[model samples]
Target: MTIHLAVDDSVAVLTLEHGRGNTLDTATCRELVLKLEEAADGAKAAVLTGSGDMFSAGVDLLSIDAGGAAYVREFLPALSDALLAVFGFPHPLVAAVNGHAIAGGMVLAAGCDHRVAAAGPGRVGVTELLVGVPFPLAATEILRCAYGTNPLAALMYSGATLTIDDALARGLVDEVAAPEEVLGRARELAARLGELPAEAFAHTKAQLRQPYHERIAENRASDDVHVDRMWRSAESLANVKSYVDRVLKR
Candidate 1:
């Protein structure tokens, strides 16, 4: 399966295993939404994580470059939906960031109620500005909600990817654990959070994210067109190509 699903007691574990970096193409993005919906329906809490050396590298640039404008039109909306599903999930959700989480990956991790990063050499941050891509409306709100206005602005402007320690200090992650213990630590955190009265937790989460939801709902149509425009723009395409070239060289 492109997305692996399992249940450990009451916690649903969703592990991304599509390929190196666990990049989210249109298919994976859509699958993620379905998986989360299923988990939310059946599980008390959920843990989202990655296998091997990447939490995720973010959107699949190669896929976008290959598919062009038509694909961008399809993918951006799916991306927004996937992110909203995670950001607005009612029950306690934890991100077990095992490795690098760049751009959209960072946004996904940040959306969770609690973020736990593995100790060692993983880097995490929002680098969309560096890629010459703008955030979708829902994503912008998620970042604002996750990091507040100032820090989100700083992170985006600098396009800096930070070490686990820095990510912890910056509130990108709630805690840091040994590489071997990242998933375990996340599960522990999830279990504790799950102990809260279910209705109260769900109600409070809705209250916290309601503003973002409303904002996204208001601008989704315009945001969809704007993101598609950005994705197909010459500057953004060039930047994506350059990034792909650099990664290929390594």
Candidate 2:
């Protein structure tokens, strides 16, 4: 499975494991949503981390190249569901950014309450425009919540990938831990959050996120329609194919 779940005491840890990049395809996205649901039900708080040098490279472009628009139609909604599940999770969620988190990967981290990065060369950013696609509605809401309008626009427009220190300076990540200690730090924080009164935590979190949640709900359907159209367009497919080829050649 792309998502591996483990619970110890009150903290559930979900690790993303799908090849080196942990690319989020339709199956992986569905598995992520299911794992988050399980984590919420059984654990008071959760920590999400990646298993290798890359947190996630975002959507599986290789899959897109092979499957074409039909895959995009299926993958987009699954991506939205996985992200919304994390954003609206009842318990506090901490992101242990083990490595590069690009595009949807950044969105996943932004969905969490806290984001901690491992100290090293790992980069983080929203790269949708780099891939010549628009952000899904849920991802846009998460970005708006994580960054101010100007910074958000700059990051998306530039497709800038910041190092851990730069990500911290820009508030993309809360703390930087030694590479080996990243998961530990996230778990420690999750344990602390898990200690709070469950009802109060849930209610307050709901209130704080209600606006973003509502905005996503309101725009999701329409946004998906437009995004799907873009994916199905010949220009988008050609760009995606070209991107995939470049990456493969590297």
Candidate 3:
């Protein structure tokens, strides 16, 4: 299954479970969007967690290697759809990040109303560079919208995975808990948020989240260019993979 869900009174817990690392595949993305919509429609608050030992490995590398151009062409809007849906959800959304959470995985966690990470070396960042891919238009603005200007540059250039503490310091993550306690902590946050006045909470949330949405909308309204597809000699996925493999190995 792409996702797993459990309901507890006013709270809904969602899990990303799609392989060894919970990488966001096309199928997984679609499943998550549908599941989150279901959760948002009924639950007072929702908490999303990753399956197994990872928050997410980011995107499915094999998918990209097999269908890079088509994937990028379609991925922007699919991602935006999911993010906007979460940002506009009627109920509070919480992310109980367990580990890694790089690239698109980072996007998933950040889109939530609240973010909590398991305390460890598990990091947060947009690590597409390490995979020889680009964040595309919507994803970039989404990151900028959440973390603002300062955090954007660090994520883009450094591309270094920030520890959970660093993630909190950078305003990328909201709370930290022990690995085993992540779900419980997220449930607690969900329960607390559920107690707030839903009307006021939603209004305030709308006010806060729209800027990012607006930014993403603006970026997507036009066509932007990138070099990820260059060197196609024509382009060979193997060539790109070699570059990524070498970079990550370093």
Candidate 4:
């Protein structure tokens, strides 16, 4: 399984463990949705983190290059579904960003109610433009909600990865901790938030997020069409290939 769930003191910890980087692919995304659903059913709160030294390297770009346009068609929707599931999860959710969270990975972190990142070399940023893909509506909305439009616009446009300090300054993460303390800090926050009355917390969360949900609902159909088309285009595919080559060379 790409995601492993462990529950303690009514807090569910969902660890992304697909590979060295815990990259997100169609299957991984679907599994994340399922795991979050399971957490919601049984746990008062959830903490998301990644295995090894990375939160997530982001979308499985190598997989995308190999899968081609046909796969892109299937992957985009699943990605959106996964993002929505994380963003709309009723209970408290925290992110323990133990390492790098790039591109879609950063979006997932932003979707959480609160994010705590580890100190050290770990970097965070939105990099869809660098990967030659547009942000899915769900991703754009989530980041916009987390960082506001001005900062979000700058991050998206530059596709620049930021250090843990820069991330905190820009509001990408709420707290910073030592690498080893990241998960503990996240769990502490999750458990603390979980102690609140469930109904009240859920209600307040819904109210805060309601506008974004409505915005997504109204524009997703059209926005996704454009996003999917861009992702599947020959130019974008070529760009993905170049990116993969560059990374492989380094």
Candidates in order have lDDT scores of 0.88, 0.90, 0.75, 0.93
CA lDDT for candidate 2:
0.90
lDDT of 2 by residue, 1-250 (tens): 9899999998999999986788889999999999999999999999998887778888888888999988888888998999999898999899999999998899899989999899999999987788788988888888898776788999999999998999999899999999999999999999999999999999999998899989888888888899899987889999899988887547
How close is every model to the real structure, measured as TM-score? 0.97, 0.98, 0.87, 0.98
What does the lDDT read for residue 50 in candidate 4?
96
Residue pairs in steric clash, candidate 1?
A: none
- Lowest summed lDDT over 10 consecutive residues: which window, candidate 4? 241-250
Query: What digit string (tens of lDDT, one per residue) describes model 4 on residues 84-165?
Result: 9999999999999999999989988999999999999999998889878898999889988888998788889999999999
Better of 1 and 3 by TM-score: 1
lDDT string for model 3 (1-250, tens) is 7889788988999998877778777777777789888887778899988987688877776565667677755554565566566566778888899888988788788778789899988988887665445665666766776788786877877778888898899789988999999989999999999989999998888787677667666666553344334312234456556754674335
Native-vs-model 3 lDDT? 0.75
Question: Candidate 3: misplaced stretches above 4 Å?
Answer: 224-240, 243-250
Clashes per prediction?
0, 0, 1, 0
- Candidate 2 clashing pairs? none
